[model samples]
Target: MRNLTQTVTRWAPTGTDAAGDPIGYTRTEILGRWEESQQLFTRSDGTEAVSRAIVYLASDVAVGDFLLQGSSVSASPPSTAWRVEAFRKVENLRGTDSERRAML
Candidate 1:
């Protein structure tokens, strides 16, 4: 399988509790090399937690270069549920598949 680099761009919470405080945080993680198609993974932590992975194919990138990124969330409260949001491409990196895909 082809490989690509993935990066985390944003991670925040969504919704609010009765006290008017944010119930949880939502996270948007990006994966891929610069100048290439990038994949995005969105996850949330709250009363209703959710997450998803998206693949983006850019005009500059080849079909095999498109890689999807996955994500997961861990909460202090075990009762909180985690769900998938959406899957899409967000950014792109550089280097060969082996180089870009390697996580340091």
Candidate 2:
């Protein structure tokens, strides 16, 4: 993780309303520490994907949850969001304090 930290708002699904429509994710939103990087990830099926950013929090998250982040520029109000496509966890190391990596 990098020292350049940013705020992340995670929106999780709550439930539905009267007409079987999706309701609020207000109570489901969670804030976390996020960092931006330029790392590419490889999948089990031999496919490659790029992750625009990363979340450093340890809380669990599901697919389709919204990830909100403020723009990098200081004087700009533009922000971006992404859906959780998938996540991967890797473990094992020779000599390092960190032994695991969680990629999304």
**Candidate topping lDDT:** 2
lDDT of 1 by residue, 1-104 (tens): 13335442333446667877657654444554423233333232223322223332122221112122344443321232222243233343553322212111
Could you give me the TM-score of model 1 versus the true structure? 0.22
Query: lDDT of candidate 1?
Result: 0.33
lDDT over C-alpha atoms for residue 21 of model 1: 60
Q: How well is each residue in 1-104 modelled by candidate 2, as lDDT tens digits?
A: 34325555665557668886546553233445665765787655677777776665434566545566643322211235566555543432654323222244
Q: Model 1, stretches more than 4 Å misplaced?
A: 1-6, 31-72, 75-104
**RMSD for each of the candidates:** 14.2, 7.1
Steric clash pairs (candidate 2): none
- Give all TM-scores, in the order shown: 0.22, 0.49
